[model samples]
Target: MVKERNKSFIFYFFVALTFMMTSLFPSSGYAAESNILDLEAKSAILVDAKTGLILYEKDAETALPTASMTKMMSEYLVLEAINNGKISWDQETGISEYVYKISQNRSLSNVPLRSDYQYNVKELYESMAIYSANGSTIALAELIAGSETNFVKMMNEKAAELGLENYKFVNSTGLNNQDLYGNHPDGTGAEEENLMSAKDTAKLAFHLLNDYPEVLDTASIPKSVFRDGTDDRTEMPNWNWMLPTLSFAYEGVDGLKTGTTDLAGYCFTGTAEKNGVRLITVVMKTNNYQERFGNTKKLLDYGFSNYEMQEIVPEGFQVKEQETLPVVKGKDKEVEIESTNAISILMKRGEKELYQPVVTIDEKLLTTEGALTAPVEKGTKVGTLTIEYTGENTLKFLTEKGDDLIKSDVVTTSNIEKSNWFVLFMQAIGGFFADIWTNAADGIKGLF
Candidate 1:
């Protein structure tokens, strides 16, 4: 009997251990493993174009070589100059010796500029935008700042102004200074490449798209002829393969930039819109050209699939327990307060309940016990209602200065006037009599 009991005990112990191991380490067919969306890139980020809300990130803050992606900053400054009337689309600018020599290097992305010929701003911009032409980018830099050196200063300054935190702009074209053959911009080493974090790169792209949306018109062109009907005509094909006209066409994809170098691998800043929701994504240092777009698709797909623009709080929404504020010396005793606008945010699907509305009244405007003064007009601003997220994942935006919470103005729903003097006096008398009656009743109860 003892031997039999020992055998059963050992058998049960092994069975329990096997069960524990299986529970801790599931097989490849586990359902939970299917939910993970991983990217094959060094660093990546996804953002909502409308709200600047970061939806996903992986090592996004680490600064890395950005290669030709630096041209997005150049594109921004060029558009800014045009908007400020400092430059014009028809303005003709002659190429410098440095630009002309770079243009002749067919090995690099260029549109062979003639030393004696001047090109209009529009064509040069198209070449740079569509073909990622290094020479055209340099020419535009010189045209804007009189030299690449001054342009580099402007890039850094604009990066700061745009709230880009981790970045260093060494050159405009995103090329290694050594690629410029000793004629690179001043104050930068020959081997140094422009560096920017994936987060900052997304911020720069966000600002570029927001400030100068017209850039999309040029950036979306699939193919264009540089200097058409002229001797310098060159077929410029967009490097962004995700465009609808490209081999790896993705719906709603358009108007961004791509970068490649030995150090930077293949990087891309891509944007797309579907069903009125737009997403911006950046993938840096992918192994190959195809992999960059592949990883971008993964990020975009995951964002669109898992999240959506949800109107969590409707317009004129009132916070619970904060629906009204007492009004002193007013026609009415209290006034209703509500949100000025609807609160909409990109939220994970099925997680709307995780967000709660928080109302903060202007303390100075409030009297004792959160009462407002009389003569409050309809639509008068009272306080702000901000949405607070209560979920596991921490929310972040493209810029540090960006407000993480979605806020709307809290305002009075109706007008309230001061009570007439006669009405006030009558109320005071009524209150005095009521107090005497309450004291008398209390004494009678004590006697009983």
Candidate 2:
């Protein structure tokens, strides 16, 4: 007996270890087994833009200088202003004397900013986002917020509103203004620069893509000439080499920003769509420009090939699959349940056994005798069914209740006739406490 017990213990221990180790290290074969993944970057993350799901990551929360990535936020704010009708695409804004001088700085990337020649809001925005033109960005900031300093404040405020904790913005252009040669273009000294982790950067990009898809419309244009149809028209090629114009472009690769600074190294926050799936990859501080794009391609390939979105609950679809539960009193003897929302989940390539739901019906849905009571109505929310993702694909969703636990409503599919005795005697008993139970449950739910 003792020898048999020892063997059982050892076998269970190995099973537990396998689960743990496989989960920690993601394997190319199966993601459900967490095999420790590696990436060549200071920090990196791959996420589902729609669900805000982190597909894979490394030091994803470590803040670092973002360089031109700051323009993403600046661009978002400008478009937000346009979306809100505060500004129009054709509205012409004058180039500040400060912006004009900064544009002349050969050290920074810029478009030709002439004080005498005004550019439309749309042209200037494209110049700022596509070329990372500092002058165009500063002009947009000043036009939107009255000063670059105020614009930076708005940037930080927007970051906070988005629940991003790992971000700091001292300038809208993501450049070290004060440390760079001297005072800022707007004369407000810049210092300390800006920083954001891979996770926060992904979130920022997600919002940019979701809230203002027009950003992609601008980003997708591989090359556009500013002040077009005019002599001063300057052609600008998007710095994001992943675009089709660049040989390194990936299929379905489109709009997004890239960043490079002495401190930031080569960084890119890239997005692509294949078949209806879109993914966001933020690779920061890679050794070189090529590596940034190369690693992003690898991440995108892994994501697109290894996972897919599965619709678990189609809205308004009848859910009558689960076995019916017993009902005691009332008109019916059992009930089945269903979900209303079109719930979807991101799952691995071929792992179907990752989630097993443990149906938990509310006690109230059962009778006083602890049996499911009848007189149940179809489509009525009887209780909640909880599906706990387990084993290989154990993703967690932290809530006050539990992590990675999903719940859906359970309802009656059909009615069952109640016993005459139960109907007669139980009605009296139910009348005595039904209101009390209703009040108590409602109060408890209210407290929650």
Candidate 3:
């Protein structure tokens, strides 16, 4: 009786331990609590361009005027049309009356455009990017989408596809004309301000950089000639003061756009690369043009100083650190698994070491759990690995106290060939006995 009572107690104890383990370390892994940095701008955000991980954000969802920054989307659409073979760099677009009048407005930034001179896609794009020329921007928009109305529709569609939460474009120029709902002076395009949240703006910038990085080719030019070598030639200087050519330029800063409007105040989307790490910082509604640059510099300084991107699980990372798994029918009864893609995590400096890795096997890859069936091909994803940040404590494999930082797919390292009839028979026998033992063990435990 004492022996039976002891067995019951032992079974109950293990069951309790199993529940505790499941509760403490869930199969999905733990999500880490993030600490955000303080920012000064009315709407600002900093994100790791590659990882799409947001490092800092303040009122980033509130929509505000984006001003000439709206040109980014207009630029993206033109590039898309070029890439899809719908248009070429040499395609010409005539300047419309609306484009001409807007360009003539001394209040707005623009290049000297003539209604008689038709500009190529390349020259117009250059003028739009370098000079923030409203006429050049609308010209490109009209050329791509047949009309500014259709072009703005395409812009909003692309925004939706990119998961932008709050973005509304009333005109290609991003001008603030309270007469937006009413008829426009041209009797064609709506005269309203373009609205975008800082976070959405950052997201749009990422989409632009990731998909059409060539846009930077124009954004990075310190100085370039617009409609060069002609009677209408004009020299356009890069408005982005963060370029190294400028006295106040920050290190590694590169191509992006800037904006200033009465309603939006001042805004800038800037990118920089250092030591193989690239960061995207967006500042909206600053006091002035100079202050926008200052806010961007602060965000970039904080990002580069505090965070480091580290490759934790490299692509083809040998699973179990080179450990092999048993196979049911393969000629060799064991096979190896590896990571499918390289996995990196951006963390605060010196904080990466506190993380621990946990592999959640989709199949029972354990030797005792029975071998996986043969015919496993190389790169066959079979499981996932979760990395948990254990906070201040340095955790090796212990993760109960840690936060789940990143997850990566684990795959087969090599192919498992089919087995001969004899090997199959042997595997079948072993599986049968393993199943019997498991069933018996479960039955005994069930009594408790």
User: Best TM-score goes to which candidate?
Assistant: 1
Every model's TM-score: 0.88, 0.77, 0.79
Ranking by lDDT: 1, 2, 3
Residue 279, candidate 3: C-alpha displacement in angstroms = 0.9
- Candidate 2 residues lying further than 4 Å off, grouped into runs, are 1-38, 179-189, 313-335, 358-387, 392-448
Q: 142 in model 3: Cα distance from truth in Å? A: 0.8
Q: Which stretches of candidate 3 lie over 4 Å from their true place?
A: 1-38, 178-191, 229-231, 319-322, 364-370, 391-408, 426-448
lDDT of 1 by residue, 168-274 (tens): 99999988888998997889998999999998999999999988988889888888888778887789899998998798789998869999989999999999989
Residue range with the least summed lDDT across 10 consecutive positions in model 1: 26-35
For candidate 1, the per-residue lDDT at 242 reads 90
Which residue pairs collide in model 1, if any? none
Error of 1 at 180 (Å): 1.1
Q: What does candidate 2's lDDT look like per residue over 306-341, in tens digits?
A: 788876555543435555666766565555555545
- How do the residues 264-338 of candidate 3 rate in per-residue lDDT, one tens digit apiece? 888898999898888898898889866888889878887787678887777666645545667766777777776
Evaluate model 1: give its lDDT. Answer: 0.88
Best model number under lDDT? 1
Each model's C-alpha lDDT? 0.88, 0.76, 0.76
CA lDDT, candidate 3, residue 326: 74
